[model samples]
Target chain A: MAKGFVAITAERCKGCGFCVEFCPTRVLALSSAFNSKGYHPPHIVSAEKCSGCDLCGMYCPDFAIFGGRYAR
Target chain B: MNEATLEIPYEIPEGARNPVEPFLRMDRMPHIWCAGCGIGTTVNCFTRALLDSKANLDKVAIVSGIGCTGRVAGYARLDSFHTTHGRAIPFATGLKLANPELQVVVYSGDGDLFAIGGNHFIHAARRNMDLKVICVNNMIYAMTGGQTAPTTPATAITATSPYGVSEPTFNLVALAEAAGASYVARWTTYHVKQLARSMEEVLKKKGFCFIEVISPCPTLYQRRNKMGDGLDAMKDYKAKSKVRNGAPTGECTLSKTGEIVVGKFVDRERPDYLELLKAQMIESLGDRYVEPEEACCSEC
Candidate 1:
């Protein structure tokens, strides 16, 4: 199966968790690290499990995250 | 070279850009909307629509009135205006009339568009002005402490309606149709794909187009009314929304507990304001009237 990955621009994330909450594969989690704005951004937890569905990007209002597919 | 050493390094491309980045003003990071606020979702769909419609970004303009949704104009990277409360429609009208080539979009909240700006809304629709109006109906005045709004559902608890709202709410879809709008649709944040498609259609359309986005205000409206958070509201929408394309506008009213009728309620053709004006001038003046070299030439 092809694996998908997501890249999150930390600085733009407002720690809304919409991306994490809406991720069907539950591969995202809010990170302890904070950006300059002091907001927690989403990070990949189970990289291998990502489906690259891009639901996180669709539901995200911040435009801080995006997803794509890759062959393992 | 050894097989291990000959392997190409697998690396994600550098400078990868988010697909929606070009449509947004990245400098305005960390937008003011609360967590789970549906306004951003609407923005996402809208930006996607802009991309899908192949609209000329330089010639597109976004106008917004004062409200939470009004902030859309500021976030959009295209030509945008943050107008006064309830005045976004009129402002957009002027922009469209002055520059017929430009695609004018009015993004605003229900309170600002329907309450304080109700008169402008009716008139704009009646004239069938060439404008795309996206009204985010969060059911309450989110920025103003969850006050009851014209789009608020009857008997819904709000900041100003502690005892539950008693006034009848405005059926926006019906109102738009009655006022002679050429295109009308309604969708929720949960329906992202559909919403984006609808926005694309609106952009391609010529006459007055209105899309009501039923979103959740988690911070104010939901919390005050015990409607749970944004996700919960979205879940309810998923369960309760009914899609009836081309349904009668009069049957599209949103009830407190009834199923939400969501779909393309109206789609038709009509001569827009500028088209009518040009025809009238040609008929009245015959060969004497001279057409302007350009619709709104800045040099002229």
Candidate 2:
């Protein structure tokens, strides 16, 4: 089970890939799927790798992705 | 592709709002920024800073001058004013004088703040006005088709400077310190945590506080210079940045593809304009001086 998860507002994403490129744990990647505006948003790659540091949240210029650690 | 049709690979819970949602005007969803613009990221740090500072939303006012970053005032969910081009500092000064209780923040782009409103910025800092100035220095003027701004690094090709800019660039950190700011710091978008922390510190402290945020303009600056996208610029920032606290402000030089010195360069306490005025009045006027009553209007 993953220790943390990222919640993405796919519709708000502009596909800049900042979150995917900067995620310390390499948990996300730009998905082939496109949003309504035709930009490729990111998707989870290895759920367990997510540390929920929210560095993705800080790097995301579009304010689309944010991470959180699950309560123990 | 509708949101429902395109399934994001992650299992997202329904009705989950991004923590930044409340601070932003959600109705203005889909902001006007480009795919890799960094202004919104700065806004995220700012909102986080505000949260950490525990500032009263009602008493915090955001002022902006015309430019891409200037749009922050409109998007922020607070008492915000979108002023004329290059006039954000003057407007903020007036706002601060009118209501001393309000924590006034002047947020604008490099062109708006340094190029046109240059004098206003220096004067405000000289007076040690209690204002928070956040300059998002993207180097080029992104909104105006990437024109060469005052802070644009040398040899960088901009819209207006087709032959490559030959003129020297402005040292924003040095300028802020020389202008008499009580606190000065420089950070790039990649250093979001430090940037947010510095911003929070500025809010808690008084007097003129300036934070220069070097952000990426991928659509224009990066693409024109063949520097790839926003992520590439961020990677460069991450690899080359050196954080030296208390480093002399005059030595912080920003060159194209060179090591960037980032950290708090100056922090000193100086009487703000309001404080100086009060002290002078009490000394000179003696018994004749009467304290100005607080805001009469309850809704101020």
DockQ of each: 0.36, 0.60
Residue-level lDDT for B39 in candidate 2: 92
Candidate 2 global lDDT: 0.90
Which regions of candidate 2 deviate over 4 angstroms? Answer: B1-15, B298-300
Model 1 lDDT per residue over B230-249, tens place: 77888889899999999999
Q: Give the clashing residue pairs of candidate 2, or none.
A: none
Poorest 10 consecutive residues of model 1 chain B by lDDT? B1-10
* Interface RMSD of the candidates, in order: 8.8, 2.4
Q: Using alpha carbons, what is the TM-score of model 1?
A: 0.90
Q: Which ten residues in a row have the lowest lDDT in candidate 2 chain A?
A: A1-10
lDDT of each: 0.87, 0.90
- For residues B1-300, what per-residue lDDT tens digits would candidate 2 score against the true structure? 544434444555555557787888889878999888899899989988999999998999999999899999999999999999999999999888888999999999999999999999999999999999999998988888999988889999989999899999999999989989999999999999999999999999999999999998998898888998888888889999999999998899899889999999999999999999989999999999887766679677
lDDT of 1: 0.87
